[model samples]
Target: MVNDIIADERSPVSASGHAYGEAERREANLIYEYADHLQRHGHRVARQLIQIPGEPRPHRTDLYDTSTNRLIEAKGTLHREAVRLAIGQLFDYRRFLSPEPALGLLLPAKPSADILELCRALGVKIIWQEGGGFTESSGG
Candidate 1:
């Protein structure tokens, strides 16, 4: 199982462990850029480690922006599978969080319209990197 690691309050999630694959490197960069963006906007971003009743390990959120009451799960790609994984992760992370917070999917770029609509229906915000900033589509 993936370890639910924690990030320092001052930094975003690190690559951790050994070396990173090409894909993993991209994801790590995404997190760092996103974290910086949040900080620039005066948002408090941190990662949460949650343990389930029967789980052997905890789960970690990609980014929890307390400033906006938002919990985000991020992926490096806009592929259908990546978005699907982020959506599921957001739900799982939200379940164990107090005050729940709004859910968001963080991606390298915008997804298809259908995916955005699905997220809207499920009340999951879509956040994507655009130019030097980020674009957000609030959930329904």
Candidate 2:
């Protein structure tokens, strides 16, 4: 439901419609900052909308690198619950992308060691904000 909520947030609706709390808003800002950072690094970033057959609505991925087939899912935090949700989203988005790119997670900060381990086990690259740039963990 997070995706659905966020999708609504992109529209002109009541705050209660999206219902993203403070942490969620902060995380959304991080995604914007991350996208700008990537642009400065020469990576063309764009949102990818995935439309499933017979589905009335489509799902949107946060950022995708057109130059390099990389799909990125951004999170405000890499806490346990956020990571879990991101993993599911990355997988779902990947299936719909043409040529299915490599998947990555963008976070405001590095997560706990255990969470990083979980990402590695799932084969999702971890990229966290560092200073004004981003650091890649290349999770196992």
Candidate 3:
């Protein structure tokens, strides 16, 4: 059940070999894809990008749940380093964005115990995406 409505435009890639400007766009796409999937199942979803003042113009956090009014941060990882990077970024963003009661969605190649423990230590919830959809799991 896919209900994707492409509302945003993509940003041009930068010349540094790093798609810096496209991070938010990529995150938005992931959020929209997930939200659309949920919406097809009759759940209302709202996605937002939290931009903290005086900090980097754009911060992490692909989507947010408007119904529950929860802040959701999405992380896509294929390796340990990627997970570490995402976790570190999430901590920083959580501090800066200051979203009351923040939850993190870790989209990893495989679910690792170490990752879950880290999220728990940071007081963040976990959501794992496997197969074609996602499942919430206890961090402990």
Candidate 4:
């Protein structure tokens, strides 16, 4: 895994002309923090690179929990759009991985009721910061 690229706290890289904003920074921090939380629980979380068919570049996952066999995508906010985007990313990332890990979404806070239902319907585990640790939705 890329030596925990996001965990290194390096300057953000923006693909578009605009620079990285607070939202991007927040998402990166959330991913890093959640990965640390997973580590303390004796789980091995690592960044992953996937080369999709007909794609010239690789896509990087926020973190993959090797111990639990789950792939996680983190979003900075609980907004519907953000969660929707994360869901899309997890699905896209899943098809290319060899072991087909269970999908997870890490958020800064618990999502709204509808959002929670949406994730549940899609079989996406919702994990959010709670107290000093993280809380995960039941099932996959």
- Highest-TM-score candidate: 4
Ranking by TM-score: 4, 2, 1, 3
Give a tens-digit lDDT track for model 1, residues 1-140.
Answer: 01222342223334574454555557766777887877777877778878888999777667788798888887877888888888888887788888988998888888899999999999998888898799998664
| lDDT of every predicted structure (CA atoms) | 0.77, 0.77, 0.58, 0.83
| 7 Cα displacement, candidate 4 (Å) | 5.4
Per model, state how many residue pairs clash: 0, 0, 0, 0
Q: Write candidate 4's Cα lDDT for 20-63 as tens digits.
A: 88777788888878877777778888878888889997888888
The stretch of ten residues in a row with the least summed lDDT in candidate 1 is 1-10
Clashing pairs in 1: none
Candidates, ranked, lDDT: 4, 2, 1, 3
Q: Write down the lDDT that model 4 would get.
A: 0.83
* Model 4 error, position 28 (Å): 1.0
- Tens digits of per-residue lDDT, candidate 2, 40-113, equal 77877777888988989887778787778889888887678888999899998888878979888888887888
lDDT by residue for model 3 (1-140), tens: 22233343334555566675444454455566677766777776654455777776564355556555455665554456755776666666556543454666646334678777776787666766668886766652
Give the backbone clash total of model 1: 0
Model 2, stretches more than 4 Å misplaced? 1-9, 12-18
Clashing pairs in 2: none
Scored by lDDT, model 2 comes in at: 0.77
